[model samples]
Target: MIPAAPLASGRTADVYALDGDRVLRRYRSGGDVRAEAEVMRHLYAEGYPVPRVHHADGPDLVLERVTGPTLVEALVGGDVGVRSAARLLVDLHARLHALPTVRATDPAIRILHLDLHPENVVLAPAGPVVIDWANAREGPSALDRAMTALILAEVAVDRSLPLSAAAHELLMAYVAEAGPLESVAAAARLRADLGAPDAARLPDAVRLVLAAGAPGDRAGAGNLALPDP
Candidate 1:
């Protein structure tokens, strides 16, 4: 049975409690969830920290009920430090990029968690579990790193945000440890494509990315937007 109200809701989905420690993640606009489920299953099989999938059909996905504060909450509550958060994000990016893509045929391709940020990371008892595979795709690893940096920089450059100072510190730390980043422009375009309110701030975000020593955008880098399966 489904709950009358969702336990939590996001930009595209609502999560409702179900029996036996499971959740129903229902997308508001109703789209097939097989691709997302398949990706999560693949990652879980590879020993990556992702919530286990129980069932997936149409727009509804039944998933393991991972309980814990989000990484953002932990950061705000002093459970984790900015440097630790940066390292954690960097580590997650490295581990995820090391995994093989589920559907892409290219040997060079890897699974990109385009939306891997603090809000999507759950500090569960077992470990940090990455959630929301709605934007997963097979692509260059740099895009993933760039997307993360762009997301952080977007908030970092906006003084009006409560966490702006903290975000700036984290962004600097992340770029310092994340090695190389070469797709900021592509990442910004993808972010803008979402038509989020912050889309207007992408120019500032990109400037911050460059200021942090990332290559920004190179000659041949292309924006990525794989269609949902």
Candidate 2:
């Protein structure tokens, strides 16, 4: 049964409490959720901190109701530190990248959460559980890491957003521990295609990402612009 109101909402979907233990996440524009559900199920089987899926049909996915503040919420409330958040993100990426792909011909291909930013992570009682698999795909781990870095970099440079300064510090710390960001340009291109509202900030985002990376690897990236999608 559908609830009277959504428990939460996001760019592409809204989550409604179905019961005490479960929630239904429905996309605004209806579409099949089998692929997304399959990925989440695979991740859960691999012991990742994704919500347990009970069912998926059309645009609706029923999943375990995870309770806690999001990573962004925790950080904004001073419940977590920038360095700590950076480390946690790195750890989550490492764990996710370690898992094998659900189905891929290439061995290097692993499950990639194209959107792994703080707002998409729930700091549950058990641990941090990642949500929103809409952008999930099988790809090189570097691309996934690059996506996250680019997302943070966007916020770091956007003065309109709250916690912009902390975002910069978080970006610096995250990039330091994030290893070679060789796929940042690719990530930027993919992000550009998503039609994000802050598309104008992408040029600045690319520059910030380059600056945050180690000296030599930043070449050919400092002046990068969002390729037309």
Candidate 3:
């Protein structure tokens, strides 16, 4: 087989353009690529806007090539794009979490996309398409929302990007669409369930940006107060 031209490279895989609007992905050996491929296949079959799997050869996968600018690039452009991307994320999370839970009987079947940052989403004419399912697993929707919110907040702060008026709107949208108080409670409960370590690490990871104007000698500091659970 003729070698494919490299399209993109990430920490765990290299994606190459294949013939006729397809892409081939060669994953880092001994990684979770196989499981990711399986998840993609399942979601695609269930009508999610995921890449179509054409074939799987060992650790390599051939999938339909989605042509579009990544959401991250768009968000980095300006306020309008950031707000648009945030709205799309809220919608995507709702749709994904609404999927039948019976299909997630496998312990690995979780609603949480452990990494739901904008970089992993593509904005196509057809709408937003989520990619890079390697870190996805079955879990609470709140964790998913929290992860997305945290990432977006960090990106906004780090890049000196203005938060769109839609930031709170999108958050409220998620709250509204997620239904009655039960859902809100569930989300808060899940966040609390994560325990101190996981919860502490998230804000800490973004502390530099979040606390950009804080006093001196804050580097490597662990004094940030976490929210009461």
The local lDDT score (0 to 100) that residue 147 gets in candidate 3 is 55
How far is 38's C-alpha from truth in model 3 (Å)? 2.0
TM-score of each: 0.91, 0.94, 0.65
lDDT per residue for candidate 2 within 1-229, as digits (tens), equals: 6988999998889999988999999999999999999999999998999999999999999999999999999999999988899999999999999988888878799899999989989999999999999988998988899889889988888887887988898898898777657677777778888765577787778778877783444655654566542
At residue 196, candidate 1 shows an lDDT of: 45
The local lDDT score (0 to 100) that residue 167 gets in candidate 3 is 38
Minimum summed lDDT over a 10-residue window in model 1 is located at 220-229
Candidate 2 off by > 4 Å: 214-229
For candidate 1, lDDT tens digit of each residue in 69-174? Answer: 9999999999999889999999999899888788888877899989998999999998999999998988888889999988998899889999998889989989
lDDT of 2: 0.87
Q: Who is ahead in lDDT, 2 or 3?
A: 2
The weakest ten consecutive residues by lDDT in model 3 span 179-188
Residues 130-172 of candidate 3 have per-residue lDDT tens digits of 8877667677665576555444433333333455333333434
Q: What alpha-carbon RMSD in Å does predicted model 3 have with respect to the real structure?
A: 8.2
Tell me, by TM-score, which candidate is best.
Answer: 2
Candidates, ranked, TM-score: 2, 1, 3
**Number of backbone collisions per candidate, in order?**
0, 0, 5
